[model samples]
Target chain A: MTTISIIGSGNMATAIGTRAAKHGHAIELMSRNTAKASALADQIGHGATVAALGATPAGDIVIVAVPYTSAVDVVTHYGDALAGKILVDISNPFNADASGLATTPDSSAAQEIAAAAPEGTPVVKALNSVFGHVLAHDTPLDVFVAGDDAAAKAQVAAFLESIDLRPLDTGGLGMASVLEWTGILLMGLARNGAGFDIALGAEVR
Target chain B: MTTISIIGSGNMATAIGTRAAKHGHAIELMSRNTAKASALADQIGHGATVAALGATPAGDIVIVAVPYTSAVDVVTHYGDALAGKILVDISNPFNADASGLATTPDSSAAQEIAAAAPEGTPVVKALNSVFGHVLAHDTPLDVFVAGDDAAAKAQVAAFLESIDLRPLDTGGLGMASVLEWTGILLMGLARNGAGFDIALGAEVR
Candidate 1:
C-alpha cells in the first residue's frame, strides 16, 4: 500500500486523506497546528497519522491541500523535506473572491509549487478541478494531471486509481495553468446554476 | 430554424457554417474577400449565401468566427449593423504561441467584442472550447455559453441544439475568460499527448 501525506487539515486535505485511507493506502495529515491535525486524524476514522508542518513527509507522495498562496508557502517551507517526493498540488489558484484566477496566464499554483520545489521534486497538479463535496461522496470524477516528470505522473495516477478516481494526463508542467483555469470555468458554471456539486472532466473521443 | 451569419472565411467559419446549413439554418458567410466567402458558401452548399465584410449580417445570430483581434475589428467595423442582433463571439484570445491568453485577466475576447459592438447588441460567447475538426464532422460536443441577456443565450442554445451540440450556460459574459481559458487548457492537453480530438464536458452528479 502507498503512503500519502496531505499537508493541510482543511476540507480538501481531509477529503483526500479519508478516501486514501479507505482505499487501504496509509494517510498522514500534517498541519501547522498539531492539535487540529490530530483531531482531523481521529475524525478520519482510519489509521490516519499526523505530523507537524515543515517536518519530513513519510509518504512517497505528498499532497499540498492548502490554498494557492498557502500551498506555495508550505511547499517552499518544506524545501528539501519534499525533495525526491511526488508533490500533488490541488490548489485552484483562484482570486480572493473566487471570481477568477490569482495566477497569471502562463503560471498556476502547481507551476509555482513546481518552480519553488527542489530540483529532484516532481510536482503534479491534481484534484483541483473536482469539487470537494463530490470527493466527500462516492462519484466518478475525472482528475486531469499535469507534470514534467513521466515517472512521477505514473505514480500519481496509480494513487488516484487506488482511491477510485481516474486521472487524465494533460501533458507538460506548463499545462498547470489550463488545469487551474478549468477550476475557474467550473466555478463559473456553478454560479450560472450548475451548482457546486459539478465535476469538470477532460475526455477523449 | 434560426438564421446564422458567420464572419471570417477560416476553418472555424467553415465549420460553423457547414453545420448550421446542414442543420437547416440559413447560413451567410461574410469575409473581407467576397470571392473567398462565396467559395466557402458554395462548399458549405445547403443554400449558404455570401456577404461582404461590412455588409449587414442577414441572420439574427451573427457568429464572429475570426480570431480574437479580428473579431473585435469585425464587430466594431459592422457598427450599427450588429445592433439589435445576437452576436456570438467564439474567439479563443490565445497569445502568439497559444501558451497563454492575449487579453487581460479582467477582460476576454467576447467581452471585448461585447463592448465594441453598438449598444443593444447582445453578445454570447459560444463554441470556444470545441475544436474546429470536431465541429466539421457530425459528433456530440458540449458548447458552453455565456451572455448577459437570457433571450440571447436562449437563441444561441437553440442554434447549438439545432446543430446537434449540447449548450451549457455558464453565467454572465464575464465568464468568457473562463471559456477562453478552457480552450487554452484543451490545447495544453493536446500538447501533453491527449491530442486534438478530445472534448471537455462540465457535468454534475
Candidate 2:
C-alpha cells in the first residue's frame, strides 16, 4: 500500500482518506485548522496522521482535495515541499449554479494546478467525475484518470484498483478538460432528477 | 413504427437512415443533390424515399442530420413546411480541430434549430455521442435524448428503442449543452487514442 496525504479536511478529504485507509494505505489529513484535520484523521482511524497546512506532505501521493478556485493557492503555498512528489488534483472547475463549465476547454483544473506546482511535480487528475459520496458507499463507480506523466498515472490507477474501483485511463493530461466536463454533466444530470446515482462505465458489447 | 426523415447525404445521414430503415421505420433521405439522396435511398431499399432540399419533409420526425454549421439554415429553409412536425437535431457543435466545444453552455444545436423553425416546431437532440459507424453495426450504442417538449423526446426515444438501442433522457432543452459537450468528450477521447469503438454506457453495478 502507498502513503496518501490529502489536503483540505472537507467531505472529499474524509471520503478519500477513509477509502485509502481501508485499503491498507496510510493516510494523512492536512488542514489549515488543526482540529479539523485531527478530527478527520481520528475518524479515519487506520493509523491516519494529521498534518498542519504548509508542512511537507506525509505521503508519497499528495491529494489536493480543495475547491477549484483555491487549488492554485494551495499548490503555490506548498512550494518546494511538493517537489518530486506525485500530486493528485481531484477538483472540478465548475461555475456557480452549475450552468456551464467554468474553465476553458483548452485547459482544466489539473492543468492549472500543474502550472502552479513546483517543477518536477507530476499532477494527475482523478476522482472528480463520480461524487465523493458515491465512492464512500459500499459500491463505488469507475474512475477516469488523465495525466501526461505515465508513471504517475500508473501509480494512481494502481491505487484505485487496490480499493476495488475501476480506473479508466483517458490518455495524457490534455484529456483533463473532458474529464472535468464529465463531472459537470454528471452533476447536471443528478440535479435534474436523474438522481445522485451517477457513475462512468464502459459500453456493453 | 415512427417515420423518420433524415436530411444530408453524408456519413451520419446514411448511417442513421440505414439503421432506421432496418428497424421498420419508414425513412426519407433528403439532400441538396437529388442524385446523392436518391442513391442513398436506393442503397437503403426498406421503403426509404428521397426528398429535394426545399421539399417538405416526408416523416413526422425530420432529422437535421447535416453538419453543425448547416443546422440553423436547414430549419429556417424549410420554414412553414416544418411547422407542427417534430425536428430532431443530431449535430455536434465542435471546433474545426475538435479540441473543444464550439457552442456556448446555455444553447445547443437543437435549441438553435428550435428557435429558427416556424412556431410549434419541437426540436429534440439525439444520437450525437457515438460514431455513426457504431450504429451501422448489428449492436448499437446508448442514445441520449433531450428536449423541452416531452412528446417530441418520447418519439425520438421510442424510435431509438425500436432500433434496439438504449435511449437515455438527460432532461430539458438546457441539458442539450451538456449533451453537445458529451460529443466533444467522446471525440477528444477518440482522437487521444481511445479508438472509435466508443459507446456511452453506465457502469455495470
Candidate 3:
C-alpha cells in the first residue's frame, strides 16, 4: 500500500483520501486547519495521520488538492520538503462563471506548480477532469493524467488503478492545459444536458 | 430526409457526405475543385449531387467542411445565400503540430463563421471533436454541438440522431471554444496511447 498525502481538507482532498484509504493506502492529511485535518484523518481511519501544513509529507505521492490560485503557493511553501516526491496537481483553473480557464495553455496550474516545486519533484496532473462526488463514489472512472516524467505518471496510474479508477495518460505536462479545458467541458456538459453524474470516457469503435 | 450541403471536397466532407447519404439524406457537394466534388458525390451515391461553389446550397443545412483557416472566408463568401439556412462548422482550429489551438476561446472558428454569416444564419459547431474516419464508421458516436440559437441546435441534434449519432449540446456559442480545445485533447489522447480508433464519450454512471 502506498502513502498518499493530500495538502487540502476540501471536498476533493476528502474524496481522494477516503478512497485511497479504503484501498489499503495510508493517507497523510496536511491542512492549515489542524482540527479539520485531524478530524479527516480520524474519519479515514486505517492508520491515517495528520501532518503539519509545511512539514515534510510522509507519503511518496503528494496531492495538492487546493484551489488553482493557491496551488503554486502551496508548492512554493513546501519548498525542498517536497523534493523527490511525486506531486499530483488536481487543480482546475476555471474563470468566474466557469465559462473559460483562468490560466492559458502556456501556464496551466500543473505547469505553474511544477515551476514552484523543488528540483527532482515530479508533478503529475490527475483527477482534475472528474467531479469530487463522482470520484467519492466507489466506481471505476476514467482519470486523465499528464506529466513530463514517465515514472511519475506510471506511479499515479498505479495509484488510480489501486482505487479502481482507470487512468488514461494524455502525454507530457504540456497536455495538462488540455486537461484543464476538459474540466471546463465537463462543467458545460453537466450544466447543459449530460448532467453532473456523467463522466468522460474513451470508447474504442 | 435533410438535404445536407457540404462545402469542401476534403476528408471531412467525404466522411460526412458518405454517412449522411447512407442514412437516406441527400448530399450537395460544393467545392472549388469541380472534379473532386463530382467524384465525392458519385462515391456517396443515392442521388448525391454537386453544386457550384458560390451557388445557393441545395440543402437546408449547409455544413462548411473546410479547414479552420478557410471557414470564415467560405461563410463570408456565401453571404446572403446562407441566410435562413443552418450552418454547421466542423473545423478544428488546430495550431501547427496539434500542440495547441490556433484560435482563442474568445474567437473560435464557429464564432468567427457565425460573425461572418448572414443575419439569419445560425452557425452550429459539431463533428469537430471526433475524427473523420470515426464518423465514417457505422457505429453510433457522441457528437457534441454548440450554438446560440436553440432551434438551430435542435435541428443539428435531430440530424445527428437520424444518422445514428448521439448529440450532446454543450451550451451557447462560447462553448464552441471549449469544443475546439476538446479536439486538441482527442489528438493528445490518440498520439499518446489511446490510439486513433478511440472516440470520446460521456459515460453516465
Candidate 4:
C-alpha cells in the first residue's frame, strides 16, 4: 500500500484522505489546527491519523489541498519534508467575486506551489475541477492529472482509480494552467444555471 | 426565418454560416474580401448569399467571427449598421503561440467587441467554444451563449437549435470573459494532445 500525506484539513484534503483510506492506503492528515485535523482523523477511522503541519510522514505521495492565496505559504512551511515525494496540487486562482481571471501572466497557482517546494519534489496537478459536494458524496467524477514525472503521474492515476474516479492524463505540468482555468470557467457556468455539478472529461472514440 | 449576417470570410465564419443555412435561417456572409465571401457563399448553397462589407443587410442577428486582434476593428468598421441588431461575438483573445491565456485583466475579446459596437446593439457571446472541424463536420456540438438581452439570447438559442447544436445559456454580458477564457483553456488542451476537434456541450439526463 502506498503511504500518503495530505497537507491540509479543508474540504479537498478531507475528501482525498477519506477516499484514500477507503482504497486501503495508509493515510496521514496534517494541518496547523490539530483539533480539526484530529477530528477528521477520528471520523475517517481506518488507520488514518492526524499529525502536526511540520511532521515528516514517510509517504510516497503528498497532496496540497489549501486555498490559492495560502498555497505558497503552506508549501514553504512544509519545506524539505515534501522533497522526493509526489506532491499533488488541487487549487484554482480565481477571485470569489467573479470579476475576472485571477492569475498572473507569468505563473499560475500550481506553478507557484511547485516553485516553493524543495528540489526533486515532483509536483502533479489534479482534482481541482470537481465540486466539493461531489467529492464528499464520493461521486464517480473524472480527475485530470498533469505532471512531468511519469512514475508520479502513474501512481496518482492508480490512487484515483482506487476511489472509483476516472483519471485522465492531460500531459505535462505546464498544462496545469488550462486545468486551473477550466475550474474558473466551470464556476461561471454553474453561476449561470448551466449546471456546475457536471464534471468535464474528454472522450476519445 | 431569422436573418443572420456573418462578418468574416474565414473557416469559422463559413462553418457557422453553412450550419445556419442548413437550419433554414437566412444567411448573409459579409467580408472586406468579396471574392472569398462569395466562394464560401457558393459552397453553403441555399438560403445564403455573399455581400459587401459596407452593405446594410436587414437581419435580426449579426455575428462578428474574426480573429481576436481584428474583432474590435471589424465591429468599429460596421459601426451603426449593426444598431438594434443582435451582435454575436465569437472571438477569443488568446496569444498567437497558444502557450498561455492573454486577455485584459478587466475585459476580454467579447467585451471589447461589445464596447466597439454601436449604441443599442444587443451583443451576445456564442460559438466561441465550438471548433471549426466539429462545426463543419455536421456533428452535434455545444454552443455557449451569453448576453445582457433576454430577447436577443432567445433568438440566438432558436438559431442554435435549428442547426441541431446544443445551446447552453451561460448568462449576462459580463460572463463573456468567462466564455472566452474557456476557449483559451480548450486551445491549451488541444495543443497538449487532448484533441481540438471536441466541443463542450451539456446533456441533461
Candidate 5:
C-alpha cells in the first residue's frame, strides 16, 4: 500500500513499475522524456501515472532505475526532494561494452547514490540481478537487498514479496559491491551462451 | 600433454592437480613448505611429484594458486624462471573479511600477477568462480578464462577442458576484474546461507 516513484522509463524502470502496480502499490513513472514515460504509463494501466522528470510525486519509495553511469546525474536532479525518503538503486555498474564491470576500487553504485542523495535518505540496493523479462513475467527471482537502514530494506522486501519474489537481505550498503558484481557475472554468463532464464538462487542444506 | 606446476598445497592447488593428473598431464606440486606439498603429492598419486619451492620444474604451464596478498611474493620467489611461460592466476584481490573487493579500478589480480611475472610471460585468469569442493568433486563448473594473448587463453582453455570442466573465454585480460569479483560475490552468497554445492555453468540453448 506504499506509493512508489520510478525515475526512468527504461526496461528496468517499466518492469519495476509494472510489478509495483500489480502489488497494489501506487506508481509514478517519471522520465526526462515525457513521451516515453506516458507511453509506458498508458501501457501499464491501474495505479500507474506518467510524469515529467523533476516532478516530486507523493511516494514512500523512489527507485532510480537508470544506468550506473547516469545514476549520479539522476540523484543530483532529485536533490533535497528525496530527503528522508527511501531510495532503491537497481543499476549495475557494467561497462559501456557490457564486456565487464565499471566501478571504482572501494566504492559501488549504491554507495555513490547514497553519497549523492540527501542525508537520512535510506538507500536500498535491489532488483539489479533479476532480468526485465523475468520481472515482466513475474517469475521466481531472488532479489538481494543491501542497505544501512534495516527498516527500509524490510519495506522493499515486503513490496517484493507482494509481487511473488523472494528478498535476500545481504547485509549493509558496503556489501552492495558484491550484489552489483553478481549481476555483472550473471550478465557475462548470459552473454557467453548461458540462458538468461537461468536465475542464481541460494540454497542452504 | 602440457606439464603444469602448481605453487601451493592448498585446496585449490590440490583440486587443480587432481584434475590434471586424471587427464594424464605431468603435474608438480610445489610449496614453500615441502612437507605439506609432499603430502598433497602423495595423496594425488599417479605421476604427480613434489618439488622444492625455488626449483623451476620443466613445465609448459605454471599455475599460481596462492592468495592475492601472497601472489606477488610467490611469483617473485620464482624470479626470472617464469619467463616465456604461461602463468595462470586464479586469485581474487578480496579483503580478508570478504566484505570488500581490493583491486585497482582499472587492474585486477590477474593483471597484478602478469605485471609481477617476468616480461614475455603470458598470464591467464581462470578458476576464480568455481569452488574448491566443486573442483574436488569433479562437478560441472564453468571456468571463465581471460588474457591478452589468445594463444595463452587457448592453452588454458584446453587444459581446463582436459580437467573435465567447461572453460568460457570472457575476452581480454581487462575482463579479469569481473571474473575476480565473481568469487567475491559468490563468497557473500555462501556466507549468507547459500551453500557451496551450487556451481555456475553456461550452456547455449
Candidate 6:
C-alpha cells in the first residue's frame, strides 16, 4: 500500500483521496481550509489524516489537486518540502469557457509547477483527463500520464493500477501540454455528443 | 450512393478513396499528377475515375486529402468550382518532428481552408484522428467530425455510418482546432506507447 498526499479540498482532491483510501493506501489531505480538510480526512476513514497546507507532505507521492491557476503557487509554497517526493499534477488548464487550453505548448501546468518546485522533485501529470464524479464512483478508466522521470511515472502508474485504473504513459513532461489539449478534447467530446460521463482511451487493433 | 471526390494522389487519398469505393460510393480522384491519379483510380476499381486538378469536382462531397500547407492553396485554386460541395479537411498540421501542432488555436487547417473556400461551402473536419494505414485496413473505428452546418455534418455522419465506422460529432468548425490538438495527442500516444496501430475513442460509462 502506498501513501498518497493530495493538496487542495476540491472535487478532484476528494475523489482521489476517497478512492486511494478505499484501495487501502494511506491518504494525507492538505488544504487551506483546515476544517474542510479535516472533514475530508474523516470522511475517507482508513487512517486518512489532514496535514497543514505548505507543511511537508507525508506521502512519497504528492498529488497537486488545485486548479491550474493555483498549482504553481501551492508547489512554490511547498518548495523544498516536495523534493525527493513524486509530485503528481492533475490540473487541466482550461480557458474560462472550457473551449481550449489556457496553457501554451511551452508551459503546461505540470511544467510550470516543476519550474517552481525544488530541484530533484519529480513532477508527473496524471488524472486530468478524468471527471471527478466518475473517478469518485469507482469506474475503471484509463489515466494518461506524462513525466520526465521514468521512476516517478512507474510509481504513479503502480498507484493507479492499485486503484483499478489503467495508466498510459505518453512520454516526457513535454507531453503534459499535449495532455492539457487532451483535457480540452475530452471536454469538447463530452459537451458535443459523447456525453459528460465518457472517458478517452486507446483501442489497439 | 454519394459521390466523393478526393484531392491528392498520396497515401490518405488512396486509403480514403479505396475504402469509400468498397463501401459503394462513387470515387473521384483528383491530383496534380494525372498518371498517379489514374493509377490510384485503377487501384480503387469500383467506378473510380480521375478528375483534372483545379477543374470543378464532380462529387457533392469533396475530401481534401493534401498536406496542411497545401490545403489552402488547393481550396483557393478551386475557388467557385467547389462553391456548394462539402469540403472535408483531413490535413494534420504537424511540425517536422510531429511533437505538436504547427497551427495555432486561431487557425487550424480546416479553419484556414474554410477561410479560403467559397461562400456557402460547408467544411467538415473528419478522418484525421485515424491514421491513413489504419483506415485502409478495413478495421471499424470511430471518426470524429466537426463542421458549422448541421445538415452537412449529418450527411457526413451518415456516410461514415454506411461505411461501418462510428461518427462522433464534436461540435462546430471552432472545434476544428480541438480536433487538430487531438490529432497531435494521438501522435504523441502512438509514438510514446500506444503504438501506431492504436485508435483513440470515447468509452461511455
Per-residue lDDT tens digits of candidate 6, residues A40-118?
Answer: 8998999999989999988999999998898888888888888789999999999999877787656788888889999
lDDT for B56 (candidate 6): 97
Once fitted onto the true fold, the runs of candidate 4 whose alpha carbons sit more than 4 angstroms away are A148-151, A169-172, B202-205
**What TM-score against the true fold does each predicted structure earn?**
0.93, 0.91, 0.98, 0.91, 0.84, 0.97
Off by over 4 Å in 2: A104-106, A138-140, B104-106, B203-205
TM-score of the A-chain for all models: 0.96, 0.96, 0.98, 0.93, 0.95, 0.98
RMSD of each: 2.0, 2.4, 1.1, 2.4, 3.4, 1.3
| Candidate number achieving the greatest DockQ relative to the actual structure | 3
Against the true structure, whose lDDT is highest?
A: 3
Docking class of 6: medium
Candidate 5, A1-205: lDDT as tens digits: 8788899999998888887787787889888889998888887778588776776757878899888888899898888888778999998888787665587757789999999998888899998877787778766667777888989988888888888887877778988887887787667666655567656554332
Residue range with the least summed lDDT across 10 consecutive positions in model 1 chain B:
B185-194
- Give stretches of model 1 more than 4 Å off: A104-106
Worst 10 residues of 6 chain A by lDDT: A98-107
Prediction 1 global C-alpha lDDT:
0.86
Per-residue lDDT of model 2, residues B56-115, tens digit only:
877888889889898888778888988878988889998887766677656677788888
Fnat for the candidates in order:
0.82, 0.37, 0.84, 0.25, 0.23, 0.73
Give lDDT tens digits, candidate 6, residues B2-79.
Answer: 899999999999989988999999999999999999999999999899989999999988999999889899899999
Ordered from best to worst DockQ, the candidate numbers read 3, 6, 1, 2, 4, 5
Docking class of 4: acceptable
Number of the candidate with higher DockQ, 2 or 6: 6
**What RMSD does model 6 have?**
1.3
A33-76: candidate 3 lDDT, tens digit per residue: 98999998998899999989989999889999999988888888
